[model samples]
Structure formats: structure tokens, C-alpha cells
Target: MEPASHGLRESATFDRATIHAIQRAAETGIYDIRGWGAKRRLPHFDDLLLLGASMSRYPLEGYRERCDTDVVLGTRHAKHPLRLSTPVTIAGMSFGALSAQAKEALGRGASEAGTSTTTGDGGMTPEERGHSKHLVYQYLPSRYGMNPDDLRAADAIEVVLGQGAKPGGGGMLLGQKITERVAGMRTLPVGIDQRSACRHPDWTGPDDLAIKILELREITDWEKPIYVKVGATRTYYDVKLAVHAGADVVVVDGMQGGTAATQDVFIEHVGIPTLAALPQAVRALQELGVHREVQLIVSGGIRGGADMAKALALGADAVAIGTAALIALGDNHPKYDAEYRRLGSAAGYFDDYQDGRDPAGISTQDEELAARLDPVDAGRRLANFLRVMTMEAQTLARACGKAHLLHLEPEDLVALTIESAAMARVPLAGTNWIPGAGL
Candidate 1:
């Protein structure tokens, strides 16, 4: 029914989606829970434009000149830092949240692209370790599958303070998705819903975190990099505190960061945008006199090379991707549209990752559905996508007269909107004004 045909106007405050939410709440008496990142529109990388070289600056020839994309992370305190050919990396996605095959595919793709992949919440899997050249083991509060041996085997360790999608909340794995293998890995009952602890049980403050870092360094003989990851809220202080706690690298995840399952309210209401948090994190690092010494990796809504280049220009050493990587592995392919519809969603609109019924096999724990994904083929597709992103970033860097991706500065960028100019700390297009620059 079209409102226009009935000559009726819809309320701006109570839209159709809002009305549906009210109806759902009344029917189920439960708050909505779903997967993916923040769906709300916010200031993002698209609001920033790169200024190509014309008069004062010189642009490099596309085929004749070189623009390096190599990046070295965790050079501050680690004996062996991660030296990658490109700055893009795969973000953490737990073994329980994703199938073993999907984890292996991520490892293969990242390895082929000369980058790193992380072991998310439920701990390291043998398949991922075997396929990945450089793997960062995530140390979450849950301590799901954590072991000293896995810690020693990891190339790097990331201590997760919080996730962007649920800043003050824990992770959720419904009973439907909690298969025997997933339950065993997480040390929980096979058909029971699990919720992780929001904070580390042993540590409460920076001092304890410092001790934890020391323990991790001792466990690994100080050979591996120690990273501290925090959600976008209080990013400046979080970065400062993480560095003070002896972190070798810091990763800031914005509100747009994806999750396997979380409350709808938490996903849309908590944390700031990636564009707004990057500058704050950079300022914190600069103030500590370790701007480049302690690397910064930002994640949230990074989609392509343009977003990656923009993040680098804003002072991030690298960018991590989660949702985009899954898409690359064919999570929402058009061929699965019919199956998606049967599941009450379309290919592009599917976000029910916790249901354990994924048609593409990238997010399910079901045996038959999981087998539908060919890890080898999916890995090749992911590799191709990563290569294209790297090339796109290089193209943008050349146009901006940057000899390397790390050379891209905020000066080469201009904001298309006042909000973006204020958030990105760049000048507005065709003007020298930066909103709230002095404030």
C-alpha cells in the first residue's frame, strides 16, 4: 500500500521500520538480535576527497612510476615485526562464529596476498594456522580456547578490550549455531546459548593490563608483537593507555565493525564512526612521540582501496576488514538469492549470521551447508579482491604524488562536507576552512 495513493503522510519520527520494530517487540517480548555492523548512516570515508597533483605537486605516471604499498607493523617492542606487502589485513572472526573452512579460506587468502589474519574469540584452529603465514592470535576476555602453546605459536597477539559493535557488551552464540565442535572449542554445552564476559576477569585497569602484557611477552619470549584493540569510544585515551601498558601496536575499531551476533540497540547506538575515531587515535599516538613507532590499525566500514587510502592518509598504519572479506568469500552472492528468500531475507539484505542456516556456507556451522563453500575457490576470490584493493590504493597514491602509501598525508585530502571536515581534520573542498579546527 502506497501512502501517496491514500493521500496519507507517514510520520518522520515513527517510520515503517520503527513501526515494525515496535510490532516485533510486542510479539516476541524480546529485543532484536542480529549480525553485521552499524546500519545507520554516518560520516564516512566517501565524504573525503583526494586532491590529485596538478601544479605545485607532481603526479607519477601510471605505468612508468612506482608507488610502494609495503607496511611494517609492531616495530616498537617486538623482536619480529609483521612486514607485509600491503597494509590491508583480515580482522578477527572466531572459529565458533565462522566455520573451519571459512577460517581456512581467510588464512589462504591473506597468505596469498602477503598479509596477516587473526584468530578471533574461540581461539586458534589448526587449519588456519597451517594455511596462514602470519597469524595474530586474539586474546579475548572469554579465554575460550586459549592455551600457552597456541600463544607461543602465534606470530602476534591481540588483546581485545572491546568490540565496536558492542562496546560494553559481550559476544553471543545462539543454541542453533552452537554445534558440538563449536561448543567443545568454547568449553560450553552443545545446544545452549553462550555469552562471553564483557571484561577480562583478572584485569580491571591499566596496571593489570601492563602485567598481562608482560606475561604475554614472557610467554612468547618477547618474539611476538603485543597489540591492544579497543572500540572507537574514548579512542584517544584508550590508545594512550594501551601504549602506556607496553603495547607494540594498537587497533581501533569503530561502530561500523561487524559481529557475528549482538543486540540491535548496541550495534546502532554505541561508539563513534571510523572516520571520527582515526584522527583521535592518531593525535594520541603523535602526542606520545610514538606516532609511527607504535602502529595504528583502524577498522569499521572499510570497503575498497579508496577507504583504505583514506584511512592511511588520516594516519593509520594499516586497515583491517571483516564483513568485506566475508562478502569476498561469497556470503551474499546473487546465486543464493532464492535460498536467502526462503530464509526470510534476500541476498543483499541477509544479516542473520547467528541462525546457522547460511546458504553461501560462509557463516554456518551446518555440515551440508558448510560443505557448499569451496575453500580453494573462495580463497582465490578473496585474494583477487585484496589485489584489486591494493592496486586501487596504489593508483590513488600515485595521483596524489605519494611515492608510498605511508606517505599519504591529511594535506592531500579534502572533506566534501562540514561534518567530515570537522571529523577528519581536513580542509573543506575549495576552501581552507576546517570546521572546529581550533576547538
Candidate 2:
């Protein structure tokens, strides 16, 4: 017989973490608020594998063949669309949530990579704007730090309807992170927790959104591309609606997307996975006869070149990265392991970004900690990472006999799992069956 201790195992349904969370909630009388995205395992790009060229198709010579990775976004209605050398763009990280130095590093890196970086919730920063060659200004519900002059200054405008981390939910920046500068920019009281509005104050639905987009276009002189960003839920319908609203580009963010701070329940339970959302958004665009015309940018859980290739193969025009970008900028670095442990978290496991005590200095506003990160050095690291990701994506594209990354199709992929096959709309490996294709 097994030992009594061995026989008394933890319940998989009510695990240790779950039990602790329940206890914590009961004691605090409040839901847990944390940074980052869902930690639960979900079907992602990892479950899909690229089908390299063989007898049916010829392969491109890696040394000789040229695989174009360049992508142009927002050409549908904007006078000046972004012509990027690479398809990987940096997702938004707000000024309040990140140090100015970190924002500068992001700008430097994106500019070096010949891509764009976005201005998140708290509005544009001079450091970011100065360093970034192409900047996308995010217009959120809070209208924090909003100014018409800055709108005109930006290369593009992104109307954020939702985020992948907590769709249909507002964001929160704990009082600890709300410094005087942050308070001034957001027009909120210092040392007080702030919550962003879930919905746009002026817009109710698609009709109202259309007017808002028009207003933005008029404000920006139609020179900037207007991107409508929505969290991955009812993505097919949302994509269609965004297009109908005269958006030049549509950004669909998946559940794996990160956030500054939000309730753990909302982050884990609210949105759809990126893999599942991509196909729906693509289908909507195809059905509307604007698959490539409207330009689709997918975000959330995009880590490397393989992920980017998989997204493109599934019909995304480009990819956006957030958490991964922060890592490149020196977040969770092993060198900060001791500091992280002191904060009651370990390096690579730290998600308390809302605490404003990041040892890496990328996510906090503490002057001394922020100074620890050298923007130039961090920017170089990010640029290098971006370059590597682009190269890997190009290599995969070439392997699939594609002359351009954009030419990758669903046929170039095979799923390792039935769930992935169903979600990605790709066939299972060694089989012609797609689990839900018939339905």
C-alpha cells in the first residue's frame, strides 16, 4: 500500500493556487488584481507546425533566395500608410505604466527595426515621440493626456475598443504607481487608484464608432491611418464592424495579451485565445471582400518568428508584441533575480507590474530604478531580438517556398493537436481531417 501522505494528494479541480486565491479573496473582500495576461494553458501557436516544402513544392535556397518581409499597413484610406521593413510592431505600453527611459528604449528599438511603437493609455511622451520614427497614438476611453496637437504629430491613430487581457473591462493603475507626473498626465489625484472607462464615453456602437473614426480622420487631416483595436471576442463580427466604421486597419488582440493591472478573474475568463480569434477575424475580412485591403494586425502571445509566421499563415497581415518586447528590454532578467525574490516573486515569474517596484526598471517610475536601465543598450537588445525574429520568420517563409512572408497560407501549416486544428482551421498532422471543418 502507498504511504498515507502519498495517498492524500491535492485535488486537481481545487488546486493549491485556487485555494489560496479563494482564501485571499475572502480575507481581503476584494478580487485579486495583478499584471500580465492569463497564466492558464490554452491552445496557442505552439500546437501548429509549418509544413516545409517537399515533393509537391520546391524549396527556396536559403543563401540565394530572397524572402520579402516588408509589410505596408493602413493603405486603405490613409494618405500616409506605414511602410515597415518588418511586420512585427511593438504594442502599446503606457507612460504611466512604464518609465520614460523604457518608453524611449522601445521607441529606439522599433525605429531601429524600422517598425512602429504605440503610445498607450496615459498618452504620448516626448521621449517616445523623439526616438520613434513611426508612432501610433492610442485613443482610449479615459482620454488621458489626450491633445489634438499630439494626435496630428503621430504617424497613426489606434482607437482602442478593448484589450486581450480583459476584454469589456477597464484597466487599473494602483496608487503606488500613480506618481505626480502620472497623475498630471491622467488628470487624476495622486496616490489614488485609477480605473479607466470600459467603453468610449461618446460612442455607443458601430454607428457611433464610425463617426468617431471620421472625427479622428478629420482631425489628423486623413494623413494618418486609423486603426480600430478590439479584444478577441466575437472577432468576426467585430472585424466587420470596424471595417464598416471606415477603419484603415483592424487590430485583434488575443487573450494572451498583457495588461498593466486588472482583476485576475477578468484576465483569465474574459477573452478568446489568439489562435481561435485569428481565423474568425480573417474569415470576416474574406467574407467582406477586404481580406488584405483592410489590413489585419494580430496581437497577444506572439513571442518569436515561428509565432509570427504562424499568424501570417493564418491570414494576419502583421503581428504586434507586448510582453515579449518588455523581456527584450530587460524585464525579468536573471540579473534581477535576487531583487525579484525580495519582492516576493522570482525572475521570469514576476507579474506585479502594478506595484511600481520593478527591479528591471522597465515597468516602474522610480527614478533610481529607472536609471538602472540604459535606454541605448536596452534598445540595441530589443533591435537585435526583432532582427532575429524577422530572420526566423523569413527562414520559415522560405522553407514553405513563399517569396514573401505575406504569401504564407493556412495550407502551409499542420496542427499537432485536434483542438489546435479546429481553432486554427488547419489539418491535423498526418491526417486530412480538420476537427470542425464540416461544421
Candidate 3:
């Protein structure tokens, strides 16, 4: 009390976390690297509120009216485009970064929820494929575990150029998590650190990307949809280019997206937020006259039904979730609080997925740790979460007077902050002023 009265205050530029970071760096020459998405606050979906139908508008009855959530992706090309019952799909999280049981659980849950799950960086696993009704195989720059048979076996293919957490940067998998099985799947030496390439080896630009898309189509006999996934940087130009590159679906991942391992600096400063990126992608798609036709699947920091509804209102065909999915799978259960404490992290704060010491067994490859998670139970939990999220979205959509989830539009939203108003291109709350309109 005496110190406060005397005007003793901490500097905003050098806060407690900043001071600790500086000290940590001084002690160790190497920079700190950890798992998870950006920790810093940014303008996000939470800043936007849905406008419920009132005097001038009419909202649907929650109990009697129907709000359709079904979405058809990859309709632009492919013999069989996916028809999902819900617009919320599971995002890519690689086998190497997650246990086999975890991957299987994700597959089972997504299938049960009538949505698609993706095979991330390290290729397809039988556990995932056997359970998932619809799976998208990721064609990553690393080419880890890539196979023609797996490609053909998948329901669709995603050509990943970058992810949101570390745009223009490579991925990192610590040596500790790279066991014999992980090494075999990725064709890497056992117990050696793995680093993914930032760019594809064969392609340099969109022109080359077109050629690659053609090759992928030929490989699958054009039966599967080809998706081009990119981080949310230069999104407008990127979306336009992806369409021209013959992509049937475009996936934009924002900076808030999770990762297994990457530099802290990269996670915080590399990319734009999801709120800013979605509008740009939609604008680009609209300008090209393929907004709904091409299908835009957005990812990064998407959490609840409100976030889903907000994304839909801003013009996304669907939204994908990764971190929330893992959480639903019990990645940070309070039952493991003691174990988390031992790891110098709390149950809700554990994000060092690269350490291979997860108590919940969702992120580790260790035999004993991985055994702790029952795939069936975890799958059920995830399914429940997915169902709840869908219901929430439906509730919001109904309030917005939307007959279907896709019927949500920008006019139904208002931003809480000027930053959010600018980022989302929505009017500020209590006013009709958009922060950057006509600029």
C-alpha cells in the first residue's frame, strides 16, 4: 500500500513476462521455443456480437424452426465432394505431434459428428483412416509419410503451403518425441529433431502450383477435391491465386492457430489475426465470383458456437478447429493437475506439446503416457463438445433470422471495439460507423 501510494509502478513495455524472457535469454544463448499459438491478445471473434431479430426483423422460433447446418465442400471440382451435416470441421493435427490414440479419437469424433478430419504433416495413419468416415490427407512441404495409396484412399487432399502459427517459417519436432515408429513414418532418423521445409521443393509460384494441382487431380483420377491451404498473410491475393491454381477449396489459417512446436517470436509476430483475414478472403472470393462456389474453410482460434456464427456471418463456408478439438479430447484435464504441476505447468496452462511428457496422453508418443487415453471415451467427449458447439451456432443463426448456417451475413453483426470494427469490417456497436469504411 505504501509503494502504490508512492507511485511505484511497472513499465508496460517491460512487464513481468518480458522481464522473465529477457532473463531467460541472458541465461541461455538459445532462443525459447515452445508449443501453442500466439499468446498475446488480438482482435478476435469475441469482439463481435450477433444482432438478434427485433422490431424490424423476425427471429425464428428456437423450438419449432429449423436452422440447417449442412454444408457441401469441394463442389467446384471432384467426382465426390464431401457433404457434411455440420459446417464445423476438424483441422489438421499431425500424427507425430499427437498420439495414435488421439488421432483415432479425432477421427471417431469427427465421423460421429458427421464432419471431416484431416491427416496433418506426417501423413495418414491406419487408426485415423479406419475410423474417420471422411478424411483429408495433407500434402505438406516436408513430404513426410507421403504415399500414392494414402492419397487415393483419402476423401480429399489438402495442399498445405503454410499454417497460421508460423507463417513463412518451418515446423519443428523435437528429438524426444521422434521414436522409432514416428521416425519410420516420417523416414527420419530415430530420435533426431525434424524440421519441415517452409516451401515446396517443386513449386515456386501460383503457375507452378497449377501444374501441381493438375498432377494431384491426375493421381486421384479427379475423384477427390484438391484444397490449397495457406496462412493468413496476403490473404486476398493468396485466395485469388489459389482459385486460379485450380483449387476446389481454399483454407485460410490465422495467427491464433495452434502448433506443436515453433519459436515464440514467430508465434506472436508472424501473421494477422483470424478476424482480419476472413473478410479479406471473402472479399477476394466475391470479387472473383466464386465466394460460395470455391468453398472457404477458415481455421485458427475458432472456439465456440458464437465464433462459428461470427465466421459464417463474415462469409466463411465453414470453420475448422484444432486446439478446441484437442481440449475436447481431454488434453488438459484437471485430473492430471498434479502431473502438470510437476512439469512446471498448470492443467489449463500446459502447452509444451513438443516435450513428449503430456500427462493426458493427447500430445505425447510415449508408450505409457499414450496408454492413459482411451480412444473411445475421448472420442465420445469430443463428439459431445462438437454437438454442443453446433447447437450453439444453430441458436445464434436462428436468432439472426437465418434459415441455414450459411445464411448468416455481415449485417447481423456489430463490433465491440474500433480495432475489431476495422479488422472485421463491421459497424461499431451502437453506431453505423465502420472504422475504415471507404478507405
Which segments of model 2 are wrong by more than 4 Å?
1-7
Q: What's the alpha carbon RMSD for model 1?
A: 0.9
Candidate 1 Cα misplacement greater than 4 A, ranges: none
Q: How far in Å is the alpha carbon of 18 misplaced in model 1?
A: 0.9
TM-scores, one per candidate:
0.99, 0.98, 0.98
Question: Candidate 2 at residue 395, lDDT?
Answer: 93
Estimate, for each residue in 1-439, the C-alpha lDDT of model 3 and write its tens digit: 6776899998899998999999999999878888879989999999999999999888999978999999999999899999999999999999989999999999999999999999998989999999999999999999999999999999999999999999899888999999999999999999999998899998999999999999999999999999999999999999999999999999999999999998899999998999999999999999999999999999999998999999999999999999999999998889999999999899889999989999999889998999999999999998999899999999999998989999999999999999999989999999999987999
- Candidate ranking under TM-score, highest first, comes to 1, 3, 2
lDDT of 2 at 31: 88
What C-alpha lDDT do the candidate models reach, one value each? 0.94, 0.94, 0.94
The positional error of residue 184 in candidate 3, measured at the CA in angstroms, is 0.4
Candidate 2 has an lDDT of 0.94
Candidate 2 residue lDDT tens string, 1-439: 5555678777899998999999998999988877888999999999999999999998898968999999999999999999999999999889989999999999999999999999999999999999999999999999999999999999999999999999999878889889999999999999999898999999899999999999999888899999999999999999999999999999999999999888899999999999999999999999999999999999999999999999999999999999999999999999999999999899989998889999999889889999999999999999999999999999999999999999999999999999999999999999999998979
In angstroms, the error of model 1 at 69 is 0.7
Clashing pairs in 2: none
Give the distance in Å from residue 6's predicted Cα in candidate 3 to where it truly belongs: 8.3
